[model samples]
Target: MQTSTIKLLRALVCMMLMNSLNAVADKVVTDSPVTDLSQFAYPVQDAKEAFKREQYAFVGIQLHDTLETPGVTAREVEVWSTQPVEPLNTRWQSFANIEEDRTALLRLRQYANRYNLMTLKLLKEKRRSDTMRYRY
Candidate 1:
């Protein structure tokens, strides 16, 4: 009778742990914002043109799409700030002073510029490699 009670108690403890784990998983899924990239209008090619035109909002949207692409993380975006450090005195203060919308737009712009530059560098390297291959 005591052995049966011990088995039942172990089963109950296992059930409770399973339930707690499921609850935590559900919270994580619900907390993350679902972004539909298909709905966004601007493409990467248009991003540079949009920036040149000073259409910051469109540029921001393009950047957001780029940042959301696979292998990119929130930490990468967080590290890429638009503002220089010397002006703010502290990093947190720089981020804090801006309105949420403005801050988001700035972040997007910074990301877009970085993305464009990286793309250009890759293309140049690819071209150089192709030239070297053809010459040999």
Candidate 2:
């Protein structure tokens, strides 16, 4: 009976440790597009041109640009926590005049937010897959 009880307690402790590890493994640290972009090297004009060429570039640029504005006192971290609607809308309008690169530009612009979202999602998923790979 004593041996059985000890085994049961050991099992319980193991189970608890496993659960804790799993919880930590499942955890993900996500920041706003603003902070994420700040870590990367962004060339505003090149990004804008990439928007015209790949259109997808716009997504990255838009987030970075929105975060980089001079007097927008809001935290980039906070701004990225939510879907950046106003910036997307504004970017959409900004490219409306340039007809030649309009399609790719718009497509890229439209995808910018999604790209950032996916990047965060991938990072989260990667954290789950490889706990050591992601520092956060």
Candidate 3:
């Protein structure tokens, strides 16, 4: 009887140890490394290098003396280029010229004051009804 009791106690202890081991195994946890933008196939750092450069071609015109007549002395004229050169192209090339060979003229027939200007005229190279001329 003593030997049987010892065997039974040993068996119970073994069973308890196995159940505790199973519980611990079921509760086990694991973790992976933290993910960042630099680890992907297309990393976020590559966008900083991709950029573009734009060039604007402009022209200005000033009258010899408009203050005495219409109070407006000079005016600036701007025209967009057909083909704008990019930064990757030749750096020493000249800017594109005006397509239409005409002069923009501003007429000062009347003057309100020595500083105020009036009566502006814009002449087109070709006669066109769409052309507009105004003053501020």
Candidate 4:
């Protein structure tokens, strides 16, 4: 009789634990919000990494012919956590124009990739002109 009672008590305790675990699993969130995706960002690790990450916002800067790509300049831009920088695949497509070599991404090795001078190519300007013509 004593052994049977102990077994029953153990089973009851396990059942109660399972119920509590199920409740916790149901309440946990699995997705980040649309506008506040920073929740999923990796934490800013070091000062050097932070500075490098911050430079990503200036990836396509130009000054010679007022042709600055103005990255991170125009509003309605997407930005997650600055401190914890992340990767991206940005492009500008229109009815008649589609950017081909466009890249505004933050790489793991920030300095090595930031100044690749990709925007120096004439492809983007050509695409923009076509887009303007289509727009008008």
Candidate 5:
């Protein structure tokens, strides 16, 4: 009876771990940062052109004088402050340029890595517990 109860508990734990990992994985896979064209229109358009051409270095160059125009930065900030807080993929905020592309991609990779690390940690704990259980 005790053995059955232990097995059931272990199964429950495994199920819960898998469910949590699945949620993380799902979030990582579907994560995409969206741009608000209203505020970031010109910058995004310029960045997209450079990005598509594979001239990443020219991204900043293209947006060099973007903020030189008065009220542009303030307008962007005002619009951004009103938007919902995003969990990830919001790169075009403070700095507006092509480098934000790299930042966004890195954020996605970070999420994937975090999920992998969590899974590994859980697996290591399970293995340690199983080995200790047998020794007893």
Candidate 6:
């Protein structure tokens, strides 16, 4: 009777541990945000141009797609993250053209705000410059 009781207690303890581990696994699986890579279909060339211009916002969008795509080697994301950015002034020369690159530009603008990269004053200045350029 003593041996049977000890074995039962051991089995109960093991089951409890397994249940706790399963719960932890479920929490970990559910905690992360679900991102659908299919939603990020922006052209790679556009992303490259944006990155060359030091537009971190656009680059981040591209990074999102690149990071989420299956079979994309880890080395690719490492390269993207380590890519150098040009001087801020050189990169901030022009605002995104809304008509031509609407969605991509919109995503860039959204990320720029979220990351606090571009301030309201700077955005206004960019808009003013864009207007001045067209004034002839």
The worst-scoring run of ten residues by lDDT in candidate 6 lies at 85-94
Per-residue lDDT of 1-136 in model 3, one digit per residue for the tens? 9999999999999999999998764443111111121222221221112211222212122222211222333242112233321111111231321111121121111111211211112212211434533322
Query: What's the lDDT for all of these models?
Result: 0.42, 0.42, 0.27, 0.34, 0.41, 0.41
lDDT of 2 by residue, 43-97 (tens): 4444355434533311333432343222222454244334332333234434332
lDDT of 4 by residue, 47-120 (tens): 23443443322233222233232223332123311332232221221111112212211221242233222222
TM-scores for all candidates? 0.30, 0.25, 0.22, 0.25, 0.28, 0.29
What lDDT does candidate 1 reach at residue 89? 16
Best by TM-score: 1
Which TM-score value belongs to model 6? 0.29
State in Å the error of residue 108, model 5. 9.4
Residue lDDT tens for model 6, 17-43: 999999976664343132222333444
Q: Model 2 lDDT vs. the true structure?
A: 0.42
Report the poorest 10 consecutive residues by lDDT, candidate 4: 93-102
Best of the two (3, 4) by TM-score: 4
For TM-score, candidate 4 versus 5, the one ahead is 5
Spell out the clash pairs found in candidate 6.
Answer: none
Off by over 4 Å in 6: 35-136
The residue-level lDDT of candidate 4 at 1 comes to: 100
Q: For residue 87, give model 1's deviation from the true position in Å.
A: 27
**What value of lDDT does candidate 6 attain over all alpha carbons?**
0.41
